[model samples]
Target: MNEQIVITFGNEKILTELKAAHPDRDLMMYQALSQPGEFMLLDHSGKDSVFKAPVFYDILSHSGEDKWDGFISFSTLDLNFDQQKVFDARINKLRTNGLPDGMHSIYSLNYHKDISQRIILGTWDDYADFELWKNSSDEFIPKEYRDSPNFYSHEAYYTPAKTKKTQ
Candidate 1:
């Protein structure tokens, strides 16, 4: 069976809170490699839990086609309009242009069971590739729309945290 996972992003205090609140849950935590106090926590068997913190947390599903790890990029986008077309176009471009150098795979996911909310999870060997991809901008979505109030994005990057739970 596939693992049902939920990912959470927050600071040290929130991480501690999560651990304390869900001690029995199988979790893997990642710390931001360059940014202190930032972390990403994954609950591998988290289908039943509802984490209601101000910090970001969402159910994650993947295509199950690629192996992903090392540097990670998690971007959450809140779109005012349906984004299926935009997402499809971006994936097609990646297939045509090939992934950025040192980047392994990228997955687009639905956020918190909301269709209008989307997440982009990217795995890379270096952070530069992520920066490049983010700055490259999507041609399918016009700059004005992306910059307007209709679109909002929050992103963070991390590496595996040194912890027994993660191991």
Candidate 2:
């Protein structure tokens, strides 16, 4: 079944206000680990979801645990059909064999309004754990795959939103 996930970027104030306004909605917020003042709001409600900001995506599929703590990783990639096949295989292998330690959940989502692109979301135990997998992931992709002009990938890491108690 097709689901929808909204992505919004801003400071914590926006997220806090939105949460306060919609107390019952299941929303997950985060702050970019490397970028200050950058926050992300994730709304999984398939119905009348509210995203005040301009970023949102229609999720083709979502898997893994809904709980995310420690750190969150978001990545986007654009590839052609052949590249997608290989990409799918590699991702499937990882899922089938089990994700590496310290990685809690992994989600493969289609880019908003574009099936040719993909968005990967992962929850990690810490920055170190994410770095480890990222370094090794280069070896998993075929060398020829990198030569394709259609390949484009960008990944960012974020820490979960800090509550008033933690702040």
Candidate 3:
């Protein structure tokens, strides 16, 4: 799975500033409203991601980060306050608990400009199982979204979650 940043934005001013800051970023900003707002930035300049899925390793794969810079995009609306806190703690927990450290990062894109979320730029490695991420063609289903999932619930987000065994 190619790693891309997910941002949720319904605010015009904040979204505009963000767009201006990183016009080159491979960003997927979400809009709750019916109309997609205009972007006041330059055209996309980076190579399109070569994202794929790992079917056999469905549960083992990661999407946030792998061997390179990557981001997990999502909406806060999907999670309640407690779930949000749990997610925040778990993501940080991943930085220290597992064999690999600093492998992924979770970012929320909201309409509130008061929140300080910056755009990150660098090479990103796909984290999710290639097959599993690819087989996710059911975007319209109640649970799935093309790439902008309202909430990112994966096996890696919690302990006891396993991964490919390196030899």
Candidate 4:
């Protein structure tokens, strides 16, 4: 199945290097509003597209598969000491055990300025799937963290299509 992956860079220099190295793959870059020098490179083709780029292997701290033609959610949080440990442990469990039902993949990232801060980006096959996990009675995500102070939360639903370039 077609897959999507996001790889974040510490700064524009690294992103420029990646662009110079891999001209074949479609690499779309976005700057983070909250943190200067932070950038996110989105590759919707598949994991193989990312694996082929040597630069990705060098600087990527977090990378994961996303829904091919569904939706994506991104969030950033600043947690206390206890919350940080719990959050880390939960992320480790998810990574080791695999994603919860209806989820494609989730990535947990550390802020460049503050290591204690975290940013989570998740992709789901559909809106229903995303909601299922959020409102799950099983408590896939602990209640405390869910209600934590979220700095930002963004969601996008998209369908991939091919378009010819016009000169």
Alpha-carbon deviation at 152 in model 1, angstroms: 1.1
Off by over 4 Å in 1: 1-4, 9-27, 33-35, 44-68, 95-97, 137-142, 164-167
lDDT of each: 0.64, 0.73, 0.31, 0.55
TM-score of each: 0.65, 0.84, 0.27, 0.53
Clash statistics: count for each candidate: 0, 0, 15, 0
**Given candidate 2, what's the lDDT at residue 61?**
42
Q: Candidate 3, overall lDDT?
A: 0.31
Give me the overall lDDT of model 2.
Answer: 0.73
lDDT by residue for model 2 (1-167), tens: 43766777776876777766777877778888888778887776665667765465666444456556568887888878877787778777777777777888777778667877788777788889978887777634455656766567778888887744322
Candidate 1 positional error at 162, Å: 2.9
- Report the lDDT tens digits of candidate 3 across residue range 1-167: 32222223234555445544565564343332223442212112234322121111011123243322132222223444664455445444543454222334433322223222222121123334322432552321123222555554322111111112222
* Model 4 vs. true fold: TM: 0.53
Which number leads on lDDT?
A: 2
Candidate 2 deviant stretches above 4 angstroms: 60-63, 139-143, 146-150, 164-167
CA RMSD, predictions in order: 4.8, 2.8, 15.9, 8.2
> Candidate 3: TM-score?
0.27
Per-residue lDDT of 1-167 in model 1, one digit per residue for the tens?
Answer: 33344766776666766766777875557898668667777664636644654233353434333433477887767765546666656666775676766667666666555767677777787688677767785643457657787577778778777653321
- Score residue 58 of candidate 2 by CA lDDT: 65
Name the candidate, 1 or 3, with the larger lDDT value.
1
lDDT of model 1, residue 50: 47
